[model samples]
Target: MTSFEFPGQYYELMRRDFRNLAAETDFLASLLPDGGRALDLGCGTGTNLRELGARGYCGVGVDQSASFVEYARRMGGEGVEYVHERVEDFESEDRFDLVYCLFMTLNYLPRAELRRVLRKMRGLLLPGGHVVLEFGHLLNFVESYQPYTVAHHRGDGVLVTRLARQSLNPRAANWRNEETLLVREADGRVSMYDNFFDQAVLTGPEVRELLADAGLHVSAEYGGFRKEQVPPHGRGPVVIVATAEGAGAL
Candidate 1:
């Protein structure tokens, strides 16, 4: 499986402190009634899982990184159950009211693997249930794809600067993202860490076809946070809300 085990707690620290995706969780909560069960695919740090639990939903989180899973379990307690396994290998007898594949996690899988995971997710959902997907779109690459990205985030008396360099492979529909992080402590101490990972790049038609082939269909497609309709060639992540097969016929 893909491993991000390098740099120890740096990756966990960088992500565990981030809570911006709480808005996505809020949006999802608005769609479900009480007693909802949620499965978070690629649920890094279990932030969304904790948020869903706080909102009165039963939550399960899965991530391929063992460190991430342990951190999630430590933070979420009994409210959220975190599994240290790939989404493709994770299974359960319980069906969910909502399934989440967010933050471009599906992009990490190759095309055929993406289809298989989607099919597995479909089987884990109840009738009328929905799966929410957010990932880079074709336009995202054309309009916003940058070879390099740098950012600094503030924390308790420490400043963390992240540098990302990416190389795209149009033929294989994939890309390699290399990340280096520099952590500057208040006491004049500094440490640098790095890691690299590959992601599958996909177009709208490709994603739509995969969903349909997996017995799922897109119900809503948004380009932004406020439910903006995805344009022909728009920027920002593509947020697609899909439903299990025969959901409307029920």
Candidate 2:
């Protein structure tokens, strides 16, 4: 599996990262005690970690993109530190009260790599700590396939275009896809890039089994950031709430 994790591209992403930073922080805070320590895996630009710092939570974030790490470091407040490294290779004796990997980040990894990343997360988790992962919504599997494409012309006269196709790879039991993006500047400079990758798919009971194999157990599962219970008939991403397999307490 491959990803467009190039740090330079993060600048374009930062301008439009629409995640509700406040609500995400509040949800995380609700899961832990006061002054808790947290770790964010695949943490992009460390914006989330910065928010945790504001809430009196000390946070450690790791991402493979140096641009993201630097961006986070520059924008950070007290009690937030970032490391630029692959999530699976991150070695820290320090454990966290809350450890989370969200935003379909794991979807970028193949199955073997996903297991390694999960094991690393398990090891970094403090006893009784919880882990959150964004499993692509059940709707992804249920909904009919459709071509995905988007174009945004920023006020700054920068046009960003994205086009993509997705399909299942039955032999690998994963999603095989390709995407192309173009950046056009008003100054007449244009850059184009394309990417092909495969992402592991976790569906239904099979997902629970994968987590169990990683020494984690599902504590709860939601439809999205709203914490809505996942219904069988629903069509949305699966945000799973998990904890160390054999540990007790929150």
RMSD of each: 2.7, 3.1
Given candidate 1, what's the lDDT at residue 207? 86
- Highest TM-score, which number? 1
lDDT tens per residue, model 2, 38-118 = 999878777777778888999899887776677778786779999988777789989898988876677765667776777
As for candidate 2, its clashing pairs are 137-236, 137-237
Candidate 1's residue-wise lDDT over 1-250, tens digit each?
Answer: 2556543345555664543565677778866668688899998777777777887888888888777787777776445798888887888898888898887788876666888888988888887888888887666666756899997876667777889988888888677888888888889899877767787767778888889988997888887545767776466688888887666521
Model 2, 164: alpha-carbon shift in Å?
Answer: 2.2
TM-score of 2: 0.82
Worst 10 residues of 2 by lDDT: 6-15
Clashing pairs in 1: none
